[model samples]
Target: MPNATGGQPPITGQVLFYKDPQPLSAENHGGLGVRQIAEPFAFLRAAHAVPVTVTEFGVAAASYPIIFVGDERTPVAVMGVRQGQNLFVDQNGYVFEDYYIPAFVRRYPFVFAADESSDRLLLCVDRAAPMVSNQPDVPFFENGQPSKFTTDAIEFCKEFERQRRATTDFAKIVASMDLFEQKTVTFQPRDPQGREVGPVQKVADYWAISEERLNALPAEKYVELRNNGALGACYAHLVSLLNWSKVVNRAVRTPPPGQAVS
Candidate 1:
C-alpha cells in the first residue's frame, strides 16, 4: 500500500511488493489487460517480508512468523531471516510447496491508494507487472466499461482496504498497551566441517509483545483485550515465534551467500 502518511513524496525506496504503481483509469489504462498469475509468488522473490492485515493472523501464523516492524508496529509475515532474502521462494519463483500465502502477496500488482482530496481510496495497479499487457489474456475493460476481471480486482482491493483499516486499529491497541519489547535473536555458526564455531551470531533485532508484561496486565485490561478479539491474535503472534528457527534453517540450506536463490 502507499504510505499511510498522506501527502508524502512518492514512496521512495522499495515499495514492498509493488514495482511501479499507478492509479487505474480508463483514460490512461484503457488498452491494458492482465494475465492469470501462474506463479503467484513471482513478485515476492525479492521481498523478505510482506505486510499482513489483522484478519490474516490465524493462517499467517501457520506458515510464517507474524511480527511487528518499526515504531508503528506494522504487522508482517516473515518469509526470510535476512534482509533482501526470501527463503520461501525457490529458483522457479514459487513459494514453498504448500505454505499459506498471505493476502498481501496474493493481491499483488493491485492495491488501494487514498485520494487525499476526496478522502477516498482509488484502486491502483503496477504497470510494470509481467501480467499487465496491452495484448492481455484478460482485458481490463470492454467497450469503455470495466470488464469482469477489472470488477473482480476492484472488489478485492475494497476488501483488502477494509481489512487494512482493522489492522491499523489493532496495531494502535497493541501500541497503547505498551507491551512491546526489543529482542535480539542469535544463532551459532558452523565451520566448513559443520562444527559449531565462534560466538553466537545476531540474526535480527526486533520488537515483540512481551509475554511477561501481558501476563502482568491488570484484570480489566486483560478482559478488554479478550472482549475485543485481540487476545487470540496476540497468542498467535507468540506461537508464530517458533517459526523463526524454521526460517533460519531454510536460509542455511539455501545456496551459500553471494549466490542468488532465484
Candidate 2:
C-alpha cells in the first residue's frame, strides 16, 4: 500500500510461510480482501515443518513427529524428510487423508505481528497469498469498519498469540529443567530378496525431550512440570517420535519431484 508520500508502508517482521505481509488497515486494504480457494492449504505443500503449540501435542502426535528446532527449542511438526516436501499434502496442495491440522496452518494469510509504533501486536496479512484477492468474497472492511470476517480473524489471531506465548513459556520451562537431548533421524532403503541395501540416509537431527532424563528429575521438579501443564506435552512429544517411520514411509513412497524411489 502507498503512503501519503507515495512510498510503500514499512514491513514489521519476516515470518515463516509469509512472503509479503502487510499490516492490515482499513485505509490501505479497503479494496483488498480474502476469499476461499479450491485448495486453501496449497502453500503447505512446500513446508517441511511448521511451528506447533504445546497444547496440540496429544492430537498432533498421531499425525507427525514433533521435534524441537532452533535455539528456543521451538516444537514443530516434521512434515517431510526432504526439504520443501510435505508428504501428507499432494501435488494439488491438499492433505491425502484426514489429519490433525495445526492451528498455525489454519491461520495462514492472517498473522499477528508486533507493531513497532505500539506495544500491542498488529494484525497483518500476506497480500501475496493465493486466497487474498482484489475482489474478495470476504471483505476485510465494510463501510470503513472491520467486517465480521476480519473481526473473527482478529480474534483468532489474538488467541494464536496467546497460545504462542504459552508455548514459548513451556519451552523455557523444559529448557530450564535440562530435559532435552540431541537425536538423529535416518532411513535405509531395502532392495529385493528382503535385503536392506543402500547407505543409511540421514533425515534430520534435532533436539528432543528425554524421557529418561525427565523421569530422573527431582520429584518436585516433575510435580512442577505437571502443575504448569507441561508434563503431558513432553510425553506427547516423546510418543510422537514413533511416527518418524510414518513420515519416512511417505517420503520413501513419494520421491521428490524429479527423483525415483530407491
Candidate 3:
C-alpha cells in the first residue's frame, strides 16, 4: 500500500472477506447476493489478479436467506451500503429501483459506509469528504454487543475534516482538471474459462498497473513515464501545474539545491 501522497509504500494484500449475520432471506437480496459476489470475482481471477474470498462458514438465518456481500474465501475491497427498508423479495425476485444505485456503482464513489440502522449513508474517503480517519475496529463475534460504532464514526468525521483542511487546495486542482469531460474506461476481464468478470470501474488493469509503477520511479524517471502514459496523464498534469513551480521555488529560495541556508 502506498500513502496518499504516493509515498512510504507498504506491501499490498488482498481483502479476504466481509460478512454480516443477516440471513440471505431478504426478498430482493440487494447487491449482497451470492450471484453478484461470485460473478465479479470470476472475471477478476480470469484477468490474472487474485480475488478476495470468504473462506469461513457460519450460521445464516434460513428465514431471511443468507446474503453474502463478501466472504473469507476471497477478499476484495468492498464499500458496504446498508439499506434500511425491507424491499422484500418481489414476486419477480428483483429488488426495487431505489434498492440498488440506479446504475452500476463505481467503487470508492462514496466517503463512508452507510448506517444499517439509520437513513444517513457514509461515503468512502475517495468521495467528497474533507478527510476520514481510519480507525481499526475491535473484533466482535456474532453475539458481541458493540458500543464503539458511534465513537468511531465521530472520530472518522473529525479526522476527515482535519485532512480536508490540509488538502483542500489540492482537491481544487483535481476539480479544475475537468475530468468530467472525459469518458472513463472500464474493462470486463475474463477468467481461465473465458467467463467475463469484475465491476464496471473507472479504468483498466493496465492503467492501474502503470500508475503503480510510475509512483515507484525516481522523480525524473517519473516525469518520463508520465509523458509515455506509463504514469497517468492527470498526475503529470498536476505536477506541471503545482510542484514544478511551488516546490522548485521553495528549494531555490532556501539555499543551494543540496545545502540549507541558515
Give the candidate number with the greatest TM-score: 2
Q: Which stretches of candidate 1 lie over 4 Å from their true place?
A: 1-14, 36-40, 191-195, 256-262
| Candidate 1 structure quality by residue, lDDT tens digits, 8-124 | 223233557677877777777788888766765677877788888888988888888888888788889888877777888876778888788888887878877666566566677
Q: Where is model 3 more than 4 Å wrong at Cα?
A: 1-156, 165-168, 177-181, 188-262
C-alpha lDDT score of every prediction, in listed order: 0.80, 0.85, 0.26
Ranking by lDDT: 2, 1, 3
On residues 168-222, what C-alpha lDDT tens digit does candidate 2 reach at each position?
A: 9999999999998999998888876868898999889999999899999999999
Highest lDDT against the true fold, candidate:
2
Show pairs that collide, candidate 2: none
Q: Considering summed lDDT, which 10 consecutive residues are worst modelled in model 1?
A: 2-11
lDDT of 3 by residue, 189-253 (tens): 45679786776433211111123443555687656544544234334322322222222233223
Note the clash tally of each candidate. Answer: 0, 0, 37
TM-scores, in order shown?
A: 0.89, 0.93, 0.20
> How well does candidate 2 match the true structure in TM-score terms?
0.93
